[model samples]
Target: MKKLLIIGFLSLFFAPLAQAQLGIKGGLNVAELTGREGESSSYKAFYHVGVFYQANIIGPLSIQPEVQYSLQGGNLKSAYTNYDSQLHYLTVPILAKLTVGPVFIEAGPQFGVLLNANQSGNLQVGFTEDGQPAYGNESRPATSNFKRGDFSVVGGVGLKLASNFSLGGRLVAGLNDINDAKNLTGINDPRLQNRVFQVYAAFQFGDGRR
Candidate 1:
């Protein structure tokens, strides 16, 4: 079953490559971590840049395959301290798009490979006798406790302006836990998943729109 699925995906991805419109895109990401039981997670601002191939499949349908470098994670606040978790990923998304006039809707599955992770901010060390919190600045490598891969889903809407430029917004939701160290101490949650909202502009190097 897996082999057949892989073969089908490969066929879909590569079949349109020869006649596709090649484009480059760059975007801002408002990213967060979800599924934290008690800790609060806030959106962190980051960026993504990538290249894609889009081709027309039928009258109002198309296929797009993209390779992107995305920075994601969140600002986590707990009772004791607040910190930023930064995660870097190389991601690929294969999308099917439906276009009506100038508007397009797209949805797809995304696969990501984790490149690095880090945390920076102040850590609460103790409480003073008067009940004030004491904090110390800390920066460290946080990659040891996270999984190397992430699976996600992507959905978005965009506008096709003229023939070459476009604008879009997307929501990406992780489908699996990214935490790999269940036994590690001081962990806020045993399961951490990625959540991101992206806004982007794309330019195609072609003469006409698909």
Candidate 2:
């Protein structure tokens, strides 16, 4: 994990050495941790802002790498009946970029290390079908336990205006399961995972060149 972190940083640092340019990027993330079917999950909105460096490795093709502190994952539902989880991570993505005229397309992999997590909503059970209060046992204890080092795939597209500023959207989907337990009381419940979609504006710092 440490090695992967090092590599991601290095990729960002060296990308500028080869016809690379720096940029500031920020986005809106519609994030959620997906659970089993019929579990009823909802996603929340989070924000992310970070800087990136893009290196043109070949004609119309480049390696763009970035390091960003991202706010990801949460639920938006009744506090007493829903689970809400938020995670902060420094993410590094190595992307392959393509440009045609002013439109740019990018796809890549990202590695993230969890910096913090918080429990903002309460968990309850036996709520009525309409989410009304009801008398029943709390389904499970409130849990905040999760793991660090999440790996995922990120891909997006952008439009470059004046070759210096861009507007784009991206989606981040986690590859590893976020659940730390093999089974909750040996119930065989499947693990949950992360997924996020982002839309934002970006500014390139240098003239477009290879």
**Structural similarity to truth (TM-score) of each candidate:** 0.84, 0.76
Full-model lDDT, candidate 2: 0.76
Please list all clashing residue pairs in model 1, or write none if there are none.
none
lDDT of 2 by residue, 34-126 (tens): 875445667888998999888776679888888888988777343334556777878998899999888889998999888877655444333
Question: What TM-score does model 2 achieve against the real structure?
Answer: 0.76
Compared with the true structure, the alpha-carbon lDDT of candidate 1 equals: 0.89
lDDT of the candidates, in the order given: 0.89, 0.76
Off by over 4 Å in 1: 1-18, 124-135, 182-188
Please give the distance, in angstroms, between residue 133's alpha carbon in candidate 2 and its true position after superposition. Answer: 15
Instruction: Give the worst 10-residue stretch by lDDT in candidate 2.
Output: 135-144
